[model samples]
Target: MKLQIDRIINEEKIEIDEVIDFSNVSMPVKIVEPVKIHLNFENLGKREVRVSGEILATLRLTCVVCLEEFDEKLKIEVDETYIPETFIENRKEERPIEELSEFTYKGSYLDTFEIVRDNILEFIPPYPKCPKCASKTEEI
Candidate 1:
């Protein structure tokens, strides 16, 4: 996941049309494809930038019933908005991101590795199950 941040990108928008490999990366959750991101940026009047976007990706999950691994396409439409730590304390009228109509948020711009870690963790499903395969537990 090599994301190129905008040099003058106080505000920027990007569309990702690529596939990401997850097996090689050690993630807390299982993902099977590259997530397509429709992103928006805001300068927030600081050295830090804010990013909001939608994430679209498929995941390989073990059936909750059978405990067998399978592929499940996940279309996670995210609307997360992240800003610096200072902003969060001052911000008001904040609802939990998961409870909101969309997945939105606030965070500081971490270095490349930290950014990737946060993104992957944020979207990774805690318990993944194949909709069609959940009940077919017996070995085939």
Candidate 2:
């Protein structure tokens, strides 16, 4: 979802509860339901914003060994600081090792959908196993 950061730029802090559309979420596995995202944004200063939230969804994942599809809960905590591109340009020259790892936003909006998608994908294991399959493998 696209969050309007400009709205909270003047405010001290803001809390938002939104339901994201996972029906069109592109994933390696299948998302059986929509995602719920609860976010708190605070303006660190004029040029910086902090976004912290939780992404919750249920997914249909296939077990690698058994090859059976099963439902699983996907929950990921997101805590990121976003700054302008100019901030990176200024800091990049100071310390090359430190690097600019924080998220960057352009204009008045921040596209949070990509962040949510990436975190969810990273949370998934390369090899997924159901409870039954995991128990069977443990006995071996």
- Give the worst 10-residue stretch by lDDT in candidate 1: 101-110
Clashing pairs in 2: none
| Model 1 quality (TM-score) | 0.54
lDDT of 1: 0.51
Query: Candidate 1 residues 15-70, lDDT tens each?
Result: 43434455678765666665555545444344444555655666666766568787
In the predicted model 1, the residue pairs found to clash are 20-34, 80-104, 81-105, 82-106, 82-107, 83-107
Q: What is the lDDT of residue 24 in candidate 2?
A: 75
Q: After superposition, how far is residue 128 of candidate 2 from its true place, in Å?
A: 1.2
lDDT of 1 at 81: 40
In candidate 2 the C-alpha lDDT for residue 27 amounts to 76
| Candidate 2 CA-lDDT value | 0.78
